[model samples]
Structures are given as structure tokens and as C-alpha cells.
Target: MTNAIEFIHVKKEYQEQDVIEDLNLSIRKGELFVLVGESGSGKTTTLKMINRLEKLTDGEIFVNGKDSQAVSDRKLRKDIGYVLQQIALFPTMTVAQNISVIPEMKKMPKSEIKKLTYELLSKVGLKPEDYWKRMPNELSGGEQQRIGILRAVIAQPSIILMDEPFSALDPLSRKQLQDLVLNIHEKFDTTIVFVTHDMNEALKLGDRIAIMSKGKVLQVATPEQIAQNPANDFVRDFFKASLVKNIYDVYIGRVGMVQGYITEKPNQKSMLVDSQETMRAVFKILSKYEYVAVQEGKEILGYLSRQQVISYLSEHEKD
Candidate 1:
């Protein structure tokens, strides 16, 4: 697949410190690429540079095969949709009006823009009659966020940039929005660059993840690869903090859900958990059955309940 975005020897500096240095990365067309790291790691900064929101201090960035530096900033931004942590919706405008803002600016026909706005709202899981005339304050955080995304997608941008778009929501709300984003990706196949500090979010959403520190990309790989083989001690220690043991064993393997066996259907609910995944994930699975099947490639094994998992942890704890 052709690269939708590429950073070649990209460098960014601020005053006395470098925010990103010699970063080389490529996001394939229609893939969700996540950038993850501790605060101040330059992940967000790197994202902004793609749309010319942040000027590069050094190096080259190409979007759809054209150098970002050479493209008109306004045109480049128009072709990319951006959503941030705080959803800044217009208080006075109705949902339809808000979503139609960009298209209106481009002088699209009012009737066509309204049609597009309604379509986008529906795509984002909102009913047109209920939400069209409602003010931003009338909606919940999640609803407002969906509107923000609807606004972005209505522009029909080929790529989208999201910087912690769900970070401000409650847990349930965040999960709903995350699932919504994934569903949208499946349908639209737009290239997405998602930035977050949450490792679980990165693992769940990224087709490929870029780990950054001190303004540099340390490694870029699939979630499974990063867990199994970290590039260096920093990467290893980072995964360790997440409580991942045998990263390769966990991510690359499939665990059959007990329900699957009973239903005579393939298990799709199983997930790979790093040592860092909350006890909640394991507990959730255990609540339904006593045994879960684990697999790597064609090799399959079974794991027991909390007691068994804990006992396994304890035995390995001594090591």
C-alpha cells in the first residue's frame, strides 16, 4: 500500500530542547497509526506538523506524495480533519449548523450542505430530527464529541488527526466514542493518526504504533510486535510498567471464550492482555466461564480462572 503520510528525518526544536528528532515514519493508506508516549514526548507535535498546524524546524513531511512544506497551508488543512481533546462546539449554533460550517465556508449549495450534514450526523450515530436543531449545551459530552467528529467527516477529508479526542469523557463515554471511531474507520477507510498517553487505547486502536520519547520515535510496529520485541531497554521498561509478561505469547495468541465452545462458533471475544491490562479484563472473561483457550498461530492452550492466573503470576514473581 502507498504511504498516505511520511516523515523523513523529521526534526522539531523549541528554544533549548528538541521536541522531535530524526523521526522517520510512514502511515500506510487507510491504516490507523497511533502515536503513544509520556507527556512531552512530541507525539501531538508530530501530528500537528502533518497539517502545517506546526511548522517543521527541520526535515521533510509528505502527505499523499506531496511535500507538506510546498502545499498551501489552507489547502492542506482543508484536506485533513482535526479533532482535539476539548470538543469546541459553537454554543449558539445548532448541530446541523455546526456540521455545515466547513462546507458553507467552501460555498457549497445550502441544500447540498444540509444533506451532507444530516448524513454525517447519522453516520456518527445521532438522529437528525432529535439533534439537528439542538444547541451544543443540550447534548452530553459524548454527543457533542460525535458532532465534532461529524463536522470533521462531513468535509470528506482523506486523513484525520485525533489528539486525545476521548480523554475528557467518562469511562463509558470514552469506550463508546472509541468504538464509534473504529466503526467509522471500517466504513470510510480514512487514514487516521491518533495520539494518546493510554497504552490500552493505543493497543486497541492502532494498526501500527509509534513509541516516542524526548521528541524522537523509538520504534514503530504492530501492537503485537511492540509487546513481544521492544527495541531497547526504554521500550522494555515501558511495557514492563504495563505488567506485560511474555508480550509475544499474549498478543500473538488467540484465547477461545467458553461461550464459543458452547455455541459451536469461533471465539472472537478473546483479547491479548499485557501485564498492565487491568484485572478487570481478566475478571470479565472469568465471570462467564472457568477456562479460556489460548492460542499462538495454530498452537492452542487453556488457562484457568483467577486462582490459576494468580498462582501463575506468583510462581513467575519469584523469577
Candidate 2:
């Protein structure tokens, strides 16, 4: 796939101190890409460079294959959508007004913009009649974020930059918005560069994730790839912090719940096991069969091979 964004030996400095060093990365078009790391890891700085929220001290930055510096700031930012942790809505404007900001700025017909705004509001489960004229201050944190997200994509920009957008919300709201983001990505087929310090969010949302640290990117891979094969000590330990209490938790994190897994029916001879079964019980079943069907209650989620279980265990045995 072609790149939506590319960084060529990029570097950034703040007050004579290097904030990002020799950073090189590519985000593919139409993919939900994640940049994740602890604070001060340069993930946010790297994201800002893409939209010129932060300028590059050295090296080339390209958006859609053209040098970003060549594009005028107004044109560049207008084409790229941005969402922030602070939920930066026009506090003075109503929900409909906020969502229609970009469309209006582009001189779209007032009627069309209103229609699109209401449609999007309903798509996210926000009833138009109920929320259309409500001020930002009247909404809850999650509700405000829903509007912030809607505003970002109002212009149908091909690329959206989300910097810790959902970090400030409660767990339930965070989850709801995460689903909303996934749905929006699927519906719009837009490229998203989401920044987060949360590993679980990264694993759950990204097609591929880049792990950054100390102004450098340490590894970039699919969630499953990173789980099974961490690039180095930093990568391994960083992910390790997010793993559950024991081997069972670790196994579930890998197979059942972290990334989406498809379900397939088992054969007549296949043994069945509960996801909550102890590792010893699973080991016994695995020893006799090449693979076993894993289930939760009556639902058969998917199959896990003996080798797959062993491989996952060996990798996390140290934890």
C-alpha cells in the first residue's frame, strides 16, 4: 500500500535540546496506525510534525508523497483533521455548529452541512434533535469528545491526527469512543494516526503500532507480532507491564481478547476448553490434541493449537 505519511531522517529540537532524533516512519493509506509510548517519548512531537503543529529542525517530512514543508500551513492543516485530549471545541458554539465548522469554512452549502452534521451525530448515537443545539459545556466529557471527533472528520479529510483524544474520559466512555473511532474508520476509509500511551488501546485499534522511546522508534509491527516477538528489552518490558496477573491472563490477552480473532467450528474429535480453565487443564487437553476449541459459555470462540500455546507461554514465562 502507498504511504499516507513518511518521515525521512526527521529530527526536532526544542530550545537546543533534541526532542526527536533521526526518526523515520511510514503510515500506510487507509490504515489505522498508532504511535504509543510513555510520556516524553516523542510520540506526540512526531505526530505534531506531520501537521506542522511542531516544525522539523532537520530532515524531510512528507504527506501523501510530497514534502510537507512545500505546502502552505493553511492548506496543509485544512486538509488534515486533528483531535486533542482537551476536547478543543468552540465552547461558544452549539454541537451542530462545532461539527459543521470545517464544512462551513470550505464554503459548503449551509443545507448540505446541516444534513451531514445531523447524519453523523446519529451515526455516533447522539440524537440530532437532542444534541444539535446543546452547548459544549452542557455535555459530559465523553459527549464532548464525540463532538470533537465529529468536528475533525466533518470535512472528510483523508488523514486525521488524534493526540490522546480519549485519554481524559472514564473507562466506559473511552471504550464507547474507541468503538466509534473503529466504525468511523471503516465507514470513511480514512487514514488515522492515533497517539496514545495506553497499550491496550493500541493493540485493540491499530493495524500496526510503532513503539517509541527517548526520541526514537524502537519497533513497529502488528499487535500480535509485537506480543509474540518483542524487538528488545524495552519493547518486551513495556508490553509486559500491560499483561494480566498470571499465565492464564497472559494467554487470554494473546488469544481471546486483545486483537479480534475469528471463530471456526471444531471437528468431531476436537476437545473443548473454557477460556478460564487453568493452564494445567489446558496443557492436558493440548497434549492429546493438535488443537483445541476455546469457548466462553456456549460460544466457541476459536481454535488454539498446542504449538501456539507453548510458544505464547515460553515468551512470557519470565513474567
> Best-fitting candidate, measured by lDDT?
2
Alpha-carbon lDDT, every model: 0.77, 0.86
Task: State which candidate has the highest TM-score.
Answer: 2
TM-score (C-alpha, index-matched) for candidate 1? 0.77
> In candidate 2, what are the lDDT values of residues 26-63, reduced to their tens digit?
89999999999999999999999999989999999989
Candidate 1: C-alpha RMSD to true structure equals 7.0
TM-score of each: 0.77, 0.78
TM-score of 2: 0.78
How far is 97's C-alpha from truth in model 2 (Å)? 0.6
Report the C-alpha displacement of residue 104, candidate 1, in angstroms.
Answer: 1.9
Candidate 2 stretches with Cα past 4 Å from truth are 244-318
Model 1, position 7, has a per-residue lDDT of 95
Cα lDDT over the full model 2: 0.86
Candidate 1, 184-298: lDDT as tens digits: 7888899999999877778889999999888888989999999899999988777665444432123211222321222222344444333223343555665665544444445
**Alpha carbon deviation, residue 107, candidate 1 (Å):** 3.3
